[model samples]
Every structure is written in structure tokens, then in C-alpha cells.
Target: MAWDLSVDLIKATVQLEQPVGDGSRTVGTGFLISDPTPGGKPRTILVTAAHVFEKMPAMSAKIGYRVQGKDGVWRFDPTTLKIRDGDHPLWVKHPTRDVAAMEVEAPPEFVKAAIPINYLAQDDTFNRYNLGPGDEMMALGFPRGLSANPAGFPILRAGRVASYPLAPATSFPTFLMDFSVFPGNSGGPVFMAEGARRRPGSNQTQEVQFVAGLLTQQVELSGERLEIGIVTHAKFIRETLALLDKLPGATVTQAKAGKTVKGDPPMPPATPAVAISATAMAASR
Candidate 1:
């Protein structure tokens, strides 16, 4: 297994934490992305599941990013990412998807390791690879709010792509995998890396990596865990960002420092027509 490939993938992964007044925290996973502009500065978007924000709602939630300290060791640093600084909605939720993207002017520390937009799987890449069941895949995320190291690197879990009709991605836009996902795994990146291939019309070889989708939730049945994970396809992610790009750009409105922001929670978007809950749907053996 090319586990080393995770070095690049985890760099873009961010830990979403909402600290409560009772010294507890709500945790989830998110990643950073840079979408290129024709002639302007590329916009930095924070990608995560919409349900993440709704869990223990807060106005100004903090995102955890790792950086090396003077001791030459990585340490976690919390940055206040304002979701709603006063009356402004800092986050953009996909109209009907379980996705949300925010146009954030993150500091160099956070943006330096973001995943490039081109890593997203395009239609051609899917067709060329003939992606379907049995294809190897990896999920980089913080399951149960647990990271790999003090640097806050995500835990890399391997599984196989288990779905159909991946080529023409259906309008509902989702897939499934066999990883036993925990509650906190939502919004993590699902990817395949450096698959060796012959160059076009030549015998030369090259390596290609692509992000496929995200771990949204787990399917449970009657107090039992199914070990099947629901993956929200990458197409919806691209769609969410595209929807954001069409709007006018605006400067970030920061709230006063040290003040814990608060706001009413937003409603969770509707689930896909095919309910994959353990009770609603069974795992394909």
C-alpha cells in the first residue's frame, strides 16, 4: 500500500471542533481547497458536512490546524473561523446537498497545505479508470475525533469502492464503501493515489491521484453497527463550490476577539431519495 501518499492528503485535512461551555467539545472533519480563477486570486474554500455545523451550534467555531513549534514538534493551534459574525452568514450551504463551503481568507499557515482543485475527479477520469466495485480507496479523516499524531494528521483508513453507475454520476450524487465509519468521520476526503498508468499513445508511465468523495455518515440497525459508510460523491462538492463562485466576492467580516459568538442552528438538508440507513437498506455482500 502506498501509505506515503497520505502525507499529501492529510495536509489538507482540518479538524472541526466546537467547544462547549461545559468543557466538552463536538468534533468533525473538514478539508481546505483552492479553486483557480481565470485571472484573479484563487479562492480558498473550507469544505465540510452541513451537519457538522449543526452539531452543538456556535456562532464562531474554531478549526484546528497543526504547526511546528520552537521545540521542533507539531502542536495544535485553534483559529476562530467565524460562521456567523453578527448578522452575516460566513458559510455557504449547498441548496439540497449535505455539503457546505465557506469562502475564507485563511492565513498562510492554513492555506499552504490545501488540496489543489484539479485533484478532484472529473468525468473523463472516472470513465478512463472504469471505477466501480472492488477498486481500492482510502479515507483520510478524524474518526471519533481521533487523529494520528500530535500534528493533528488524519487517520488513514483503506477500503474498496462499492457502488454502481459511478461514470455518469446520478443526480442524487452519492456512493457507499465498507469502512466502519464512526460519528466524527463525516466530511473527510475519500481518495485514490498515484495509480500507475501508461502515457497516452506511448509506453512511458505516470502516476495520477484523485479525490473521489467524502465519508458523510454510518448506517446503523437496531442498536447494531453495519460497518457500511455512506459517501457523498465528489460531484456535489464541485457543484457546491461552483455555486459559490457565481456569487459576488465579499470581504470577511470578523467579530470582536475573545467574544464567543452564538446563533440559531440551521436545518439539516434532506437526505437522498435512496435512504441507506441500516434499517432502510441492507449492505450488499
Candidate 2:
């Protein structure tokens, strides 16, 4: 498989964590996406699920980043990406959606590492793909906060679109991916990358890729869990960004570094979502 999709996915995704009452922490995932319509300040927002942050007990959480050392080595650096200090929510949730975004200043190199807004599939663009049930898709995330290597890179998982009429996803705020999601996979990029495909009448194949959407939940029956992942359509993400555009700074209240925070409802999951917060689950374990 080509590495472009995996590369971009891992480069942009990070782990979000905060301490718990027992001196431990819960873990979730988040990724970097540029505001689709930037007006003045070239905004870069951290994208994740509202439920992920809502389960937190502290206003502030640390984001995990991989920084390259002068020795040409990558190191896992836990950076303090503050949200709110007290009762204020650090992220702006979509009015009726499970998604949320927040503005923040990150390392210049990291900002540059963000996935471009255009990478997301749009109305006409998504229509072109002609996706349906069983088409292959992939996601980059940390399952149970575990990465492939020591540098803290995300793990790549592949699945198919389990929802029909995959196009015009706006009508359907969410879709489904046929992948088993773990506790820490929420807020990760659920996308299809550009790749080669056979043309109908020709011996030649064409390359294509798309940011299908963001993974939100995993599908599970009350008694038996299925390996299905629910993904929020990227359209709502665009809508949320547009909503933020209306705000002066497109920001939620700044989460103070020292303040302790305490923090959902699930998306009426057609498919299951990865809702087990590492912190929340770990405490119970």
C-alpha cells in the first residue's frame, strides 16, 4: 500500500489525555485540520469528538506530539494543549452533531503538519467516488493509546463503507466503516486515500483519494458487539467550521494549565463508535 494516506494521517493525529483522581489519566485521539474558510489569522483547529472531551474530569488536557530531535530521531513529547480552566467548555460542539473543534497555537512545524482543508470530500467531489457498501476505507488512530512504534505514530486500520448511498452524506450526518474500533480511536481521521483503481473499459487504472469523514462511534449490539465503526460525514465538520467563522476568534474559552476539569450522549449509532475513554475505562479496570 502507498504511504501518502498513512503518512498524512499519522502526521496530523495526536493523543489527548488528562490526569484522573487516582493520579492516572484517560486517553483519546485528535487530529489537526485547517479551517476550511480562513479569513484573517490562518487558523488551525484541533478536531475531535465532543464526547471524548466531555468525559474528562479536568478542563486541561495534554496532547501527545512527536517531535524530531536534532539527532534526526523522533521523540514523543507530551505538550500541554489547554482547553478551559473551569466550567467553560474548551471546544465548540456542532449544534446537533457529535463533532467539535477548537482554535489553538501549536508549534510552527506542527501547524505546518496539519491536513489541508481541501483534503476533505465535498458535495460534488464525494459524488464522483460512487462509494457504496464494501468499498475499502482506512483510519489512523491510537487504539487504547497504543501506536505502532516508540515514536508514538498512529496505527492504520482498514475497513469498508457499510452504509449505502454513501454520497450526499449531508442527508446522513454519519456513515459506517466495517472496522473494529478500540477505546482510544475516537476523534481520529476516518478517510479514504488517493490510490489506483481500474477503469471500466480500459486496461489502465487511475489514482484517487478522499477524506471521507471522521470516525465517531463503533457499532455494537447490547449483548454482542460488531466490528462496525460509525463515522460522521465530513460535511458537518465543514459546517462546524463555518459556524466558527461567525465567531470573532473561532475559539472556545482558553483552558488554564493548572485548573482541574471535570467533564456524553452517543450519536444514535447506526454503527458502533469507539467510546471507551482510556481514562474512564482504566479507572473502572
Candidate 3:
């Protein structure tokens, strides 16, 4: 069966938010990936921009999940996800990129919704698919903290590649997309779903679909909105996921009175403990 990225990603993507203590909440986007352990134990990893977790000061954040009723209505069913312990972040980040990944215990339904790890583009995916400047791509995000509806599904948007030299992730870690980026759009996945595209140097066409990257930031100058988003290549995301295995016991360093100290490895906290009060939800708008 052919893969449909647009539909598959919508099921995997989710809204991540945390209360800012004041009236508003910090919002961002994230997607689920099915990356099993070496022993074949089922695992789910949440992938997002590192800055999303960095901006949330609280120890836990709400992951907006939705469920469809038998009556064909979708309802938002958010749950608290612990992102930090004390002052240390639980998610693993790429050494030199904006990508972040963390093991998550999602609902069984969501675990099935996760995209396979093979769907993420590698360093050679671009060349294999003949993807370059001007190629059309789609993105998913909760722009301005608003969902497609009250159900909390992310809004899907499309854009064209705006920059050149889309290869060799080492030399160019990020590329530009011609899209209107917003405050809550960070960490969303950017992907290409071409049913038929000519090969790099051949006349025959082939179906190509894969996640290209993650929207890390928007291009701006002099505080002006440029309608351009910077996307960190998916290669970095693959690398960050590997970090989870390499540093399973990694500790985050903390600064104590001008001195640096290594803290213990982060552990998952209790489930659904941090609830976003109904009053806080109304104030965020």
C-alpha cells in the first residue's frame, strides 16, 4: 500500500503547551515516532524543536491528544507530560542542532499512530528523490495557539522550498521554506508527498514521500516577519534519537552559584499530575 504522509502525520502530530504563570501559555508542535529498542521492545519517542522545551519553565507540559467518538466527533483529550525534573530537561537534544527527542509513554491508540522511524529522510533522501529548491512540501502546526478547531488538531499548511543546496546535511544543517511561520509553529514536521516525480537523471517517475525536516525558527530581520521558516534537516532528528540510546544515563549539568554540577539522569514523573485548569485555558486566548 502507498503511504500517505498528510494523513499519517496528522495522526502523529500533537500540540505541546505549558502555562507561563501569567495569562498565556507557551505552545509548540511535536510528532510521535515508533523507534523500538535493540531488544525489540516497543517504544515511542516524541520529536520536537529543543527550544520548545527550553521555553517552558515548568516541570511538566500538556500534550494535546484527540479522540474520535463513535458519533464521528473528535474531542481534545490532553494529558500532562513531564518534560523536566527540577532544573534539568528530560528530553535529549542534538549536539549542534535544534532537534530534540524523548521517550514517551503515550496512549495505546497514539502509540499506533506514530510514524515509523524509516519515514524520516536520511542524508541521501534528497538526492534520491531529486528534491531541491521550489519543491512543494507540507507542514503541520498549531499556529498562534489556534487549532483547526476546538478538537485541537494541528492546521496543515503547504509551501515550496525557498533555499538551495538541500544536500549534505553536515554543510547545511537547515533550509528555508516559503511559508508564513507563527509563534506556535516551531517543531512541526515538514515533508514531501509526491506521488510521482522524475528520477534525478532519468525520465521515469516514482512515488516519493518522507519527512524532510522540522521547523526550528522563522527568518526575520529588524523584527519584521519574513514569511520564511528555517527547517532543520531530518538527519539531525535521526542523530538525536540515537543520542537517546548512546546516553541512556546522561545527566544534565546545572549551574549552582556560578559552579557547574552534573545532576542525576532524568526519570519520568507520575502521569497526568499537572492539569491545565479550565481558567488558564480561557486566559491563554
Candidate 4:
């Protein structure tokens, strides 16, 4: 069951690529987020790395986004969606957070496969799992543009949690793990075990289920052969969801948001866009 859940989560995330200077390309990852747009929904929002979208020229030929399918397979196409707050690049710099988000026209082949993220609810359960040193985590992504390699599916890599949390570097609670992340894995998911918490009266805490963090950073030691990967706390997931709600005409609302069913809601869809943070600034040398 745990294995299945991990696969399901990967099926929902995507790798984004855009043309950069001199015909080179920048790559990152993002996962699908639920939008409440009405029928003929233009695009789905994908959260990923900020740097991936930054190096693009305004009139680039085309953008590319890739995601896993329901069958645990990789699928991709040229993206027609545009970066939301692309004009405000400084607000979404990599050193401070390293996260970026954009919307894509839902492709006909991918409509039923994507899963909308419940960032708020996931954030509420962050503490349900006591992640700490020595824990093992599974980080899955399409590294080195390997989505179509080997088996044409997302790659899964396992690693151990690092010596300490990464909050100091990212300004948020983060996990340092020993996963090998390549270019295409920048915005993938990093899931860790959240064992059942034991209460004072109870013998042990019951097991709670869900994803733990969004893979964000990695550190390469000069002499060491292996690298350490970092993941941002789940709270930022909630923040991204909130910002999505503030978009001009989004229609998605959570079950607790005065809505019960998981069906689509009425929405006046607008062009897909990436949202930029207001207080965030660019990293200095």
C-alpha cells in the first residue's frame, strides 16, 4: 500500500522545461494542483523550481512539461502555458526558496490522470509524522531527462536523512536526505515515514498516511562521491494552494471550504500564469 501511494503521488507531478539563452534549455519539476475552473478548463497549475522558469527569453519557441500517467508511465508535450508572475522574477528566486509554479493547458490525454493537491490539509498533518535523523525517504523524479529512458517512467531513488534539518538554509523546516537528484528532479516529491505518534497514555501513536515534503535542495561535498538532497516542509504546499485561490478566476474549493463533493466548481478561467511572491527577493552573490 505504501508503495502504491508513492507511485500515485509521482503520477501527479510534472517536469517543466523552457528554452533559455542560445537555444539551451532550463529544466525543473511541478505537480498538478486542483483548480475550480468550469468546463473547458484551460490549464492546470504545476509547482516547480523557480530557476527553471527564469532563464527563458520572452519569445522562446515553446515550453515543455512532462508528467507521469495513471499507469505509472511518463508522458510529455510542448507546453502552451505561460509563467504566472514571470515579470516578477526577483520575487521567486532560488536561494531563498527555489520554488516556482505555472499553469498548463490540460492536454486531452492527461485529463483523467492528474491529481489535485490539498496543500492545506497536508500542512495540517505535517507533525503527524516525526521525521528526524536516520530516517529513510523515497525521492522520485525524472532526473537527467530520463523520463523516457530505461522504462519510460519516473525514476525512484532512496536515501537517508542528513545530520540536521534544512530550515536554516531555506527559511522553512526542511529535510536533508542522501538522494541523488539530477536536472529533471528539481521539483519532485520527497516522502518520508511519519510513524504513528505515541501518546503519554497510549502505548504508541497510530500510523497516519500522506506525503511529507517537497524535494527542494541538494548539497555536493567537494571530495565526497555522494550528494545530499533537501526537501521543503509541507507548509509551503499550503502557501502555494492559498496563492492559487487568490488567482483571478480559480474555481477549486476544498471539502472544508463549504464544499462537500470532489467535483469541479464554477469558474471563469483566465490564461494560465505563475504567481510570484510579494516579499521574496533575488539571491545575492
Candidate 5:
């Protein structure tokens, strides 16, 4: 069967939010990936921008999981996910990038909805697919904490590759996308859904669909929004997932005082509302 990234990935994407003491909630996006363990045990991994989880000071956040009833109606059913044990985070973060990953126990339907691990783009994916500036790509997220509908689905948006030199992922860890990015859009999947594209240096066309990266920040110059998003390469996501195994075990516990412990400092305060270059702002209500 032909793969449909829009539908396939939308099912895997979910909204993450937690209420700050001020009545407003900090919000972000996340998606599920089917990454089985080395022992071949089925596992689901939640992938998102590290700042998304970092900005949520509370130990638990709600994951918007929708349920479909027998009548074919989908209902929003959010569940609490433990993200911290007192002050320490439970998710693994990339050493330098904004990507983060953590193991999650999702409902059976969601497990099936998780995108395959192989769907993440590798270094060769861009060159092989002739992806470059001007190529169109799609992103899924809830901008400004707004969902697509009452069922709590993410909003899909499209944009073009705005920058050049998309390769290696060593020096250029991020690429630019010509899109209007807003808070709550961070951590969403940025992907290519081109059905068929001619391979580089060849007349043959191949169906190219893969996750390119995660939306990390929005670029701004002086105090104006540039409508351009910065996407961290998926390579860092893979690296962060690998770190999950090396790090000491951590678990989520019930919420306590809702105050952060002393030892673990909160993530640096978010960039100013207006940024000089870029703003790493996760959406807040």
C-alpha cells in the first residue's frame, strides 16, 4: 500500500501541555515512533523538542490521546504522563540540539499508529531524493495551543526549504524552512511527503516520504517575526534516543508540591518575547 505521511503521522502526533500556577498552560507537540528494543520487544518512543518538556515545570503533563468510538466518532482523551522525578527529567535530550526522546506506554491503537523508526531521514535521504531549497515539506503541530478540531488533532502546515547546504548534519545542525512558526509548534515533525520524485542524476523516480527533522525555534531579526522556522536535523533525534540506554534509569512519580527541587535548576527562562535572532518559545496558554 502507498504510504500517506499526512494521515500516518497525524495519528502519531500529540499535544503535550501542563498547567503553570498562573492558570495558563505551557504547550508543545510530540510524536510517537515505533522503536523496538535491541531484544526486539515492541516499544513506543515519544520524540519532541527538549525545551518542550523543559518548559513544563510540573512533574506530569497531559498527552492528548484521541479515542475512536464504535460509532466512528473520535473523542479527545488526554492522559497524564510523568516527565520528571522531583527535579530530574525522565526524558533523554541531545547533547547540543533541542531534540528529546523517552519511552512511553501508549494505548494499543496508538502503538499501531506510531511511525516506523526507519521513516526518519538519514544523511543520504536528502541527496537521494534531490531535496533542496524550494522543495515543499509538511509539518504537523498545534500552533498557539489550538488543535485542528474538537477531536484534538494537530494542524498540518506546508512550507518550502528556505536555506541551502542541507547535508552532513555535523556543522549545519539545522536548516531553515519558509513557514510561519508560532509557540506550541515546536517539537512537531517536519517531513517530506512527496509521492514520487526523480532521484539525483537519474531519470528514475521514487516515492520519497520521511521525517526530516523537528521544529526547534523561530527566526526573528531585531524584533520582527521572520516567519521562518529552524529545524533540528533528525540525526540528533537518533543520537538522543541512543543516549536513553546509556543514562541511568529514571522514573516518573506522582506530583508533589508542584515546585521544582533545589538541586535541579529549571531550564533557562525562555528567550524574550521578542528575539534578536531566534526565539525558542514553546506555546503557552
Candidate 6:
């Protein structure tokens, strides 16, 4: 089933890890979204989480990017890619969107190897495929630092959406799901369904175009009993890309010259009539 899809699709999946302040590493999964600013040049824009990028105890972590390679392909030396400027988001000085874009110098051979990302907000047809409770999902990542066996890709663990609209009612665009999310699965793509049986030569079943959500946080349980996972809705990813377009030096256009207008962090406009009022309804005693 993995062989059927082109590299462009799989290249969007990523493994994200960074060094924390205490000399430990914090890992998760994330994927790339190809929302080029007017021009079509490549940009290293990715969607993960605000908490994921923000360092624990208020210090940010060093960001790292990983790509898929052949079973025998040795991992590229870290020096092969250079992150422009300081690695911390605060240094970049853009509003904390919980997402960040980087300018990296990738090796020549790795230039054209990434998959283009997609979004549900592109059309009504795409949004209709958004996931809800009881739907199937597959968390693809290197959980527990376990590398692939003989396969070139990481392991894919199957799961389901534990809840609907992962964010609070006030935050309509965001959603969450319950999966067995682990240490390394953050920023990974949580696919709708995997390997649905198909006949040898058919239309290929639409290629599951609805990549409805992204794996973000895993609810840590106290004991051996399994609990749930959390996913950020794909819509936030779309919004992040739109915001990136507004930033300076994003594309060929000259950045507007002046101090950036700063205020509260930017967020998507609230959904209509979705407010939660504590006093509108009478208490049932």
C-alpha cells in the first residue's frame, strides 16, 4: 500500500525533535504544508503546536528536521543543513503562532525530495472529510526512538478519534483526536484510514485526499492502562501558512520597511454564534 503513493505525498510526513534546556530531547512529529507566498519557490514552513515549539520552563528548544531515506542510506550530518540566525522563535520575533518557518540549506541531492502538503480548507469537498469521534486514524512516526526495521519508513500505529473538535468551543477551527500518541509521534500525519482493500487496477480509491488532522499532544496516563491522544485540526495549519505569507522576507517581494506592528498574538476570527455563556441558561437544580 505504501508503494502505491508517490514520494510527494509521503515526503510531507516529518519527525521533529529538539534539545530541551535540561540537556534532554523533546520529540514529536510534524508535516510540511506547501502554501507558497504568491511565488512558487520552496519554503520550509511546517505545522506542529505552540506548546511543541515553546520550551518547557520558558526556554525554547533547538529545532531539527529529519527526512526519509533508503534502508542503507546513512543519516546526513547535521552540518549539511544550516538554520538561518538563532534557532529560538523569540529571536525570529514573529508573533508566536505555535508554528515556525526556517531557512535551511539542504544538500543538493535532497532539494526535490519532499512531498507537497494539502489542506481541508481548500474546498468544501475536502472539509467534508474532516474526522470526528469513532473514525480511524494512523499515527506515523518513530515512537520511543525506534527506527524502521528493514523498511525505509517509520512504523505506523493505528488509532481512532477520541473526541470531536480538539480545541475548546471558543476555538472552533482546532480539533483533537484520541490515539496512542507517544514521544516521537508529534508533528506526524494522522491519516484517516490505511490500506483499505482495493482491487488490482481501479481508480485507486481517491488516495484518501482528506488528511483531516495532525498529531500534536499525547495524554500521559498514570499507569499501564492506555488513555488517549490529541490532534490539532488541519485548519490551523492552513491558517499558519496564511500568517506566514504576511511576514517579512517570506517571498521575493520586498518586506514593508518599518517596525512590525506588534500587539496581541494573531488568531483566527471566532466562529459565528459559538460563544459559551455561563449565565444565559437557568441551572437545573
TM-scores of the models, in the given order? Answer: 0.81, 0.83, 0.86, 0.64, 0.88, 0.61
Location of the lowest summed lDDT over 10 successive residues in candidate 1: 269-278
Model 4 has an lDDT value of: 0.49
- Regions more than 4 Å wrong, model 6: 1-10, 20-23, 56-111, 119-127, 149-152, 164-171, 193-207, 220-226, 251-285
Clashes (candidate 6)? 11
Model 6 lDDT tens row, 31-148: 5554445687675554555554543233322222333366655331211112222543432222533344443333333334443455333324223444356766665665543434
Q: Please rank every candidate by lDDT, starting with the best.
A: 5, 3, 2, 1, 4, 6
Per-model C-alpha lDDT, please?
A: 0.68, 0.70, 0.78, 0.49, 0.79, 0.43
Worst lDDT window (10 residues) for model 2?
A: 264-273
Higher-ranked by lDDT: 2 or 3:
3
TM-score-sorted candidate list, best first: 5, 3, 2, 1, 4, 6
- Candidate 5 least-lDDT 10 residues: 269-278
Q: What is the lDDT of residue 98 in candidate 1?
A: 75
Candidate 3 C-alpha error for residue 147, in Å: 0.8
Measured with C-alpha atoms, the lDDT of residue 101 in candidate 6 is 45
* 49-102: candidate 3 lDDT, tens digit per residue: 888888788887778777788999987777777788888788999989888898
TM-score of 5: 0.88
Give a tens-digit lDDT track for model 1, residues 121-189: 765676676567877789877666667775567788988777776666554377778777875678888
> Which tens-of-lDDT digit does each residue in 177-210 have in candidate 2?
7788877788888887756776546777766676
Top model by TM-score, which number? 5
Segments in model 5 whose C-alpha atoms lie over 4 Å from true places: 248-285
Task: Please list the residue runs of candidate 2 whose C-alpha ends up more than 4 Å from where it truly belongs after superposition.
Answer: 1-3, 199-204, 251-285
Q: How do the residues 156-245 of candidate 4 rate in per-residue lDDT, one tens digit apiece?
A: 788887755433333446666766655556767676433544644667665544556666655545534246666766556545544654
